[model samples]
Target: VVKERNLLEIIQKQFNLTDILINRRLKKRDINQCCQRLLDERQHFLNILTKCRLKIDKNYNLAQNGTISIPWDWSFASNETL
Candidate 1:
């Protein structure tokens, strides 16, 4: 195709240029690149996650047995024991 021919022509023209590194790296390592990519992705993820609120099953019984007092042992669970 014309695109392929143009790309090869450009490569031949810039073959002696030392200002750039076009060599593909190995699959194993890109520590700095990986860290920077992860940092960028994490920032975007956190920006979206902070504005989201998780929904739970509201129909489920959270306290069906009875009104249990605080700091008391019961069938459900006692956080005081923790």
Candidate 2:
């Protein structure tokens, strides 16, 4: 429980810094702000990757059946343009 609480606290701090960097309207942004922005972007990208991994793992077995197909009718332009 202590480990989980510490992890949550760190995440909350990161999020708070991110929010500060995002919502601040200061005329002179500092290095700390830029660093925070980078951290936030990296964290956001990691979050996206994690979600994708979970989805792929959850659907892996179902996808193996090979019954899924996507329509491609909109992939090509009309012949009139040629």
Candidate 3:
């Protein structure tokens, strides 16, 4: 009877250990996925920002070279009325 009880206890302990290990592995996988998603979003945002910067630079160059005319007929001192 004593030997049977010991065997049962050992089996229970092994099952509990396996459950804990599986839970830890799942949690780790979730964390890794979250991190990768955040990284992808950050990279996408940076790409958009770079495109915006390039567009602004192009517009600035065009304006400086007089290729693009900005409407500036109104003067602060000679404004008819707002």
Using lDDT, give the best candidate's number. 2
Candidate ordering by TM-score (highest first): 2, 3, 1
Please write out the lDDT profile of model 3 over residues 3-78, one tens digit for every residue: 4334323332432322111113233444344333323444333432222211111112333523321111212233
Clashes of 2: 0
lDDT of each: 0.27, 0.30, 0.28
What's the count of clashing pairs in each model shown? 0, 0, 0
Q: Highest TM-score, which number?
A: 2
**Runs off by more than 4 Å, candidate 2:** 17-42, 45-82
TM-score for each of the candidates = 0.20, 0.24, 0.22
Residues 1-82, candidate 1: write the lDDT tens digits.
Answer: 3543343233323332222111133221332333233234443334322322211111212234332111111122335322
Cα lDDT for residue 17, model 1?
Answer: 20
**Tens-digit lDDT string for candidate 2 (52-79):** 2111111212135332211211122335
Clashes of 3: 0
* Candidate 1 RMSD to the real structure: 25.5
Q: Which has the higher TM-score value, candidate number 2 or candidate number 3?
A: 2
Select the stronger candidate by TM-score from 1 and 2.
2
